[model samples]
Target: MWWFWTLWAVVALTHCSAMDRNKDKALKLMKQTPLIDGHNDLPWQIRKQFNNQLSKVDLNTIQTTHTNIPKIKEGHLAAQFWSAYVPCDTQHKDAVRQTLDQIDIIHRMCDAYPESFMFATSSQDIMEAFIQNKTASLIGVEGGHSIDSSLGILRIMYRLGVRYLTLTHSCNTPWVDNWKVDTGTEAPVHNGLSPFGKQVIKEMNRLGMLIDLAHVSEKVMNQVLDLSKAPVIFSHSSAYSLCQHKRNVPDAVLKRVRDKAGIVMVNFYNDYVTCSQTANLSQVADHFDHIKKVAGHTVIGFGSDYDGVRRVPKGLEDVSKFPDLVAELLRRGWNDTEVRGALGENLLRVLKDVERVRDSLTKDQPDDVPIPYEQVENACRTNYGYFPLDNTGHSASQSPLVLALATLLCWFFGGSSYSCRP
Candidate 1:
């Protein structure tokens, strides 16, 4: 009986030691660095609840949202892009108006609490916000479709302080085939970009806007990267090699992004990070490890699709749980510099490069009238042959043997292959 008591005491003491270690590690990580999330829909959430109806909830004490002044303070979220997510659909009569409304949400938040939040267009602004103990609120348009296929509208958005524009969302625009829809069955419509799309890239480059390729097809991503004068940003995406999700960036693409001096912000959606259909924290870490192995430290950052993704990694449920991620990285042997880069510096570098490109373009002006829509479409028609997996030289070829080998390897290793079921 006495021996049994001794064994129980030893087990209890071991458990307490383990808990204490985890706590200490978490505290150390929080003090070492400030976490910067690349994407969140705090503005979208605000718009969804109070779309021009400010009476519904007080902006000062927004009680019922994942991200707010109080929650950001609690989470230690030093900076984040308050995404201006406009859903892709032709049904909206005024796409630009809708986009403007989303932008207004951020403006309202900044106006309500100048001390706690500040709108940041450049890296310097972000740093200043940090110095002031304010969360730097940056803006990014979720879909290119918000511009209504007009370069004028794109310029207007840029002038309105929109920094990044996701080239495509779930739906492919008239100028690009979406990866979700482009299954290599029918002939590619826009291939990667119509001539109009090229103009869009040029305009974005000219405006210093970071051409976001997140949600675009692989072919589109390649074309945008080829055309953009500045480094690009994958605002919200993960490693496809780990989970095989269509939304995640593959190794080959990641390599090109690195070569282009671009940054691929790691996503936190469970489906993208892990093979699991549900949120799983451990599997999410695997994605970070895989991306680090392939892309190196320079190319990694966070792009948590908060409010955009229904399910998230278990430990990273909301903005408040960001500290948990910092702790996880520390456990994985990441030092302060590496953690800080992953959190925000890497993304800031891309933003600065975009600004430089914009500045260069502003210095060069053309006298020729803007190309007509018909001529743009005609130019794009010729490029449709650039479609992937099509007879076009750009298409990737698949081999049956490779598929067979992959199946065999999966069975041999774990008897299950990574799939994005949810």
Candidate 2:
């Protein structure tokens, strides 16, 4: 009995020592390299809190339920893209105006807390902000539809500091189809992009705005990948091979992104990361592991769709939980360099590429013309065999055995899908 107790004590001490080593390593990584989250809806969250009136709030005293200056500092977020998102609705007659409002809020926040935050358009700006001990405030338009299908508006948006534009949101635009709607039970309206949509991508390439393919259809994603002269960003997405969500990118897509030297900012949305519809922390970490296996370290970064997401993972309940994720990654055997890339350096590289592309484009270049709706309607009918299968024998539309089984299960259960509780 004495020998057994002694053996147990030695094992426990070894385990504790290992845990301490991991904790120290994680803390060092966090301190050395700060995290850069690609997308967060803090502007919209502010809009909601201030009663759709940004001017009324005392920027210094502003308190938010989700994200704020104090919370961001506490969370150790070095850089973030304050997403200018507008909901898809005909009722919101001027979507562009609403988006501008959100942008104004971000600008106000930066101006109000100059010591704490700085507006960053270039990778250099981000590095500068870090050196100054300030959080970098970057901007991204969440939907292409927010521009009201005007090239002039898009240029103006870029001028106003929008770095990236998510080509589509939850709804299909006149040019591109959203992956969610197109892949759903409803028939696809446009196969990928109308001729106009292709032009939009080219214009984005020329303008230096990183053409984001986060919410676009797989066909649209392919089209943009072919059309973009510069690297693109899936600002907030994950690996679909792991979670099997329309919102997540498939392994083939990730491979193409890697080949282009682009960045796939791994989204922290629970549904996108996990098989479970409800939020689960360990499952979220599993997605990071899976994405790394497929995309490699260079292409991976963080894109936590914070306020925009319905449910966050258990460990990552709020911005403050970011340290826990860093710790978890360290526990999983990620070295400091790997952790730094996942945090922000990878994103900085993509940002620099976008700035270079923007500088190369000429202002006098011809604007992209919109393709006629009739032409788009005609093309979808003729486009067949566009959905190519992967090595696993799964096309973009549906996977082979797993999807087939899911379909049968839904049918057997009277069209009710399984829902796992959090």
- On TM-score, the leading prediction is 2
Cα error, residue 2 of model 2, in Å, equals 7.8
Question: Where is model 2 more than 4 Å wrong at Cα?
Answer: 1-17, 55-64, 90-92, 363-422
Residue range 257-308, candidate 1, lDDT tens digits: 9888898877888778775668666676677777788978778887888877
Instruction: Quote the positional error of residue 348 for candidate 2 in Å.
Output: 1.1
Identify the runs in model 1 with alpha carbons over 4 angstroms from their true place.
Answer: 1-34, 59-64, 90-92, 182-187, 366-422
> So what's the TM-score on candidate 2?
0.82
Clashing pairs in 2: none
Per-model TM-score versus the true fold:
0.81, 0.82
Clashes of 2: 0
RMSD of each: 13.4, 12.9
TM-score of 1: 0.81
Compose the digit string of candidate 2's lDDT tens values, residues 105-179. Answer: 889889878988999887888888888879999999998778866678898998999988998888887777888
